[model samples]
Target: MNLKSAWSRRSFLSSLGVASGSLLTSATAKAEGMFGKKPKAETKRLVDGNPIVPITSGLGSTGDIYAELGVKPLINIVGTVTVIGGSVMKPEVMELIRRGNEHFVLIDELEVAAGKFIARLCKSPAGYTGLVTGGAAAAMVVGYAAMMTEDLEERIKLCPDVATFPRNEVIIQKAHRYAFDHQIRQTGAKLVEVVTREEMIAAINPKTVAIHFTNIQSDRGQVSGPETVAIAKAHGIYTFNDASADVPPVSRLWEYPAVGFDMVTFSGGKDIQGPQASGILIGKEELIHWALLNMSPQEDRIGRCCKVGKETIFGLLKALEIFVNQDYDETLRMYDARAKLISDAIAKFGVTARPREFNPNALGNVTPRYSWQIDPTKLKITGQDVMQGLADTKPVGIGSFGAGAGGMRGRDPEAEARMKAHPELAQQRRRGNGPGRDPNTFGFAVWQLKDGEDQIIADRLVEIFSAAPKA
Candidate 1:
């Protein structure tokens, strides 16, 4: 409606005081979805003069000024990782975070209640856990304490010099100890590395706290998942699993706790869609309770450093909810289709662009990693050059910089099963040249792309590959 019509309606409502729920609902529905154009208010920004902009807003963020000027961001052909600001959270997560912003609640009580619900979801033994440090690395540290401290007072008295804390040793397979936030050491616990099952078993003693398991690291690790946990439990020690970015089965959240990984640390920013700084530590009820009691702001609280805000909590919860209710089988299929599109587009070049399914053994992304191979010799440009071109193109930023290193050569993974099925592809991939010899592989992740964005990017990639001169 124009100004006059809007004014007339406002005047009528003022006298009537008819603030009907139906009217609010209908108006919001229309404004949010049914309306032909999105509301300018969708883009909120902070005011320069004031820290919080409750009043005036500059025209810059509204996209209105930008639309008039013709500007937009490149499509993100990646998955939801913190570096990319995480996948634009699901709509519900944004709404929940907004609700949290508008309200207040007791932090202790909030954590307590949230823990109960989260634990139930994961079937964890802990009451619930919290991270103050803002990364899953902190989650591992705080979780390490949950099992070691033994009680509330001891939990409070954490971080004494090495001589002070009892059972200060944490055994990790020589290979499993990768670049985590060092949560285990955060407890001031010592790390003892063993190279074999014999070494691990021999390493476990009275001081042994727990065995750490890392799922994503590629190095040949001495400890296997089931074996690490089994060994720890048999010796009455705890098992902590680090499954960051390994969130495909979505069911894995609860699966870890159920399978007896005393504490499992997950990247909230990467997969669970929680705050980049927040990680979830769920397992053993007694341990979870201790972990919370040890969390930050409590006097001498060991975990006083790993705090999560109301917004992060709500957003994380929302992401998890989508993960829980999401049709995994269908989502996987969609990613499969996305990979196939690019693969099929250039398949005529005699290169195999196949969809890599999500299997635990695969080194690719948690979701299916669609990769396309190019005959490097036939495509005059190096894979890196093509990557640079795509990045420098009008719609740049397709995948990671690594994918540009000519297909398959730059750590792009092959599904273990697929590797077996396509033995020739593997041998060709390991030592193939461009086009005829080297099948240029492009691994595509679907989570990062907005709706229908894959088409534009995939098509653009096809064009670049088909057009570029072969090396």
Candidate 2:
């Protein structure tokens, strides 16, 4: 049936308080309990000072909300990507979000208070502070806007239209250019591409406001972070580093700022396990002030649309606190144990699961990976087939099987045609340590998986191998 018809049917059934199979049953139960008889005072007591607790009584827990909506939740084998809901928030962070929702405060005042807390935790430089944004991309929009406008009320409102602005150019390395540059371009500043140190030095003109650095691709470019910072300082231009996914060593939160980048941004959602829509922007006090003026709690500005709720801000701070103070070595050991559980389960099927260590100082998601080598003589299925099998599991599909291609660099017909014409280009693209590229091997990281999820994956893998056709 059509979507409209289906929605109408669901709505009609919901109004009558009738359970239409499993789809509407959970939602109906929730609605009825909202106006139902109040619970006993003893039963309503906060657990461990937490105001919210899981409902375990009447309708026997409202059931899985995803199941009710017919949307299957997946076991995240992917480290931390937005497509799979990033990371789950910590219990403390969730408590803070709940607490934050209980009252209303001036957004500006709350943001300033939160910024001071972030600055202290991150060990930001003497004159630097922090600002919570919608996300890393939102941080970019405001960061750039801050440099271009600089607390000028007139320029803030007329931003993304910097015709009259004295400085409107952002210098970036040619190799560092990527998809997120679109956020920088949103401020109406021209991105000046530089390939070499000499070119970068030459590009610094009166119109240049800042130098953009892509933290993950630092080695791919001619200039390093220190070099970029030095050059920006010499020319009296600001520097902004987009280090969104470069956490988990956890020191990068303050390291980038200490390295002298005028501004640095990290994704609060990814490894930090904060609200999915939040980000942390740490930078000089003046620039942060400009950024705040250009964003929400202040309308008629470019970043007015990038509004970060109070709950999200509080959640981000709490998550950051937990992340910085976390025992990383213990976390790593836990991940290893989880991988071993899956490895031991499928070993009898001639699948050798070996641990792959991750470099702690790596520029991107730092997590240990596990690769399973399928024995072709034992099972007719290839590693890609096994990946598909896991993804096809019922109730909750398992994901992050493949190498995760085609996510950001979406379908480009022209690029595809070029790769097709040149076999070497295609070969180059396939060269990676990730799984699903080879017929015999498939792998994924277990750090993103929640408690007991590894067992579910282990059982699923056994089922796939056992049901496969004999070679």
TM-score of each: 0.71, 0.83
TM-score, model 1 to reference = 0.71
Task: Please give, for residues 100-197, the per-residue lDDT of candidate 2 as tens digits.
Answer: 88677899999999999999999999999999999999999999999999978889989999989999999999999998999999999999999999
For each candidate, the alpha-carbon lDDT, in order, equals 0.64, 0.86
lDDT of 1: 0.64
Report the C-alpha lDDT of model 1 over 80-199, residue by residue, as the tens digit.
655545555666776677666756677767766776666666555444343323567767766776666766585467463445666878888777767573667767788998889899
Off by over 4 Å in 1: 1-74, 78-80, 125-133, 148-160, 217-223, 297-302, 340-352, 355-364, 375-379, 394-396, 402-439, 462-467
Candidate 2, residue 167: CA error in Å?
A: 0.3
Q: Which structure among the candidates has the greatest lDDT?
A: 2
Supply every candidate's count of residue pairs whose N, Cα or C atoms clash at under 3 angstroms.
37, 0
List residue ranges in candidate 2 displaced over 4 A. 1-62, 400-436
